[model samples]
Target: MRSRRGVIEVNTAQIREVADGVPDVCIYELLYNENIEVIEDQCLSKRKCDSAILASDGTVGIFVKPDLPEEYRQFLLWHEYGHFKLHYDENMHFNFYLSRFSWKTEREANTFAALNLLKGEDIYDQNVIALLISKGVPERIAVKTYESLI
Candidate 1:
């Protein structure tokens, strides 16, 4: 099910290959390599929102809340990159209120982040899911991670 941004075609095989090649793939480094700028900001105080992506003059800027935990912040970075990769067009400025964005858009981004960050690991394993949940992965994300691996 694709959203209005269009179908986000994620090649899990290619992502796996890249993950295998890189020692430690940092999402920020990946964004940098793609010429996307990342800014850590503490000004986004909206509940349930930790990041935003702005596209202008052919450049994508990702702003992440700096006050979140390291793991959560990393997740947010990946989520925003998902938006950049999947939803953003060179002419589209994606900044909008969280309440205004469709749930499908949010779900797509969350699924993208879960799959990419987890690297198609078998997060469905109950023990592994529990471990991830205990380690601060949101329950929704844990479920999405499991679903993506399938």
Candidate 2:
């Protein structure tokens, strides 16, 4: 289930362009009435989980700790966007509010996040940790995500 440690190989640049092209509001803001709306309705919060929500209308809500580095926040938001695009089935209205590990859905979202953030890089590579660090990823998460890869 693991690939050799190498640079992340997804086309992050294109993903980033797609992410950047999104409207300049916190996608969450567009989905919920308040930041706490996600926490209350979805039971997912930036304070606890680096997670996001996908509304049925194709809107995505991303929760990020405000204190985290901006890059990390961007990655989380894009990850949520990935769910909106990849996991959301317009015909399935009840599937939008899912947990981080709700079957294969979250996996795809995570893949979207990892690939978008570290495209052209390998999570299995030796310098992977350093590269994530250079990109302003938190040291603990960088290490944890690295470990989770294997």
Top model number, TM-score = 1
lDDT of candidate 1 over 1-150, digit per residue (tens): 235754434454543443454334677778878888888877776646678888777877888877678877777777777766656666444443543555656666666666566654565545755655654468877776656546
lDDT, model 2, position 35: 34
Give a tens-digit lDDT track for model 2, residues 67-144: 556776666665666766554555554443343335445444554555456765555646876776676556765666
lDDT of each: 0.64, 0.52
lDDT of 1: 0.64
State the lDDT at 72 in candidate 1: 77
Worst 10 residues of 1 by lDDT: 14-23
List runs of model 2 lying over 4 Å from the truth.
Answer: 1-47, 94-103, 120-126, 136-150
lDDT leader: 1
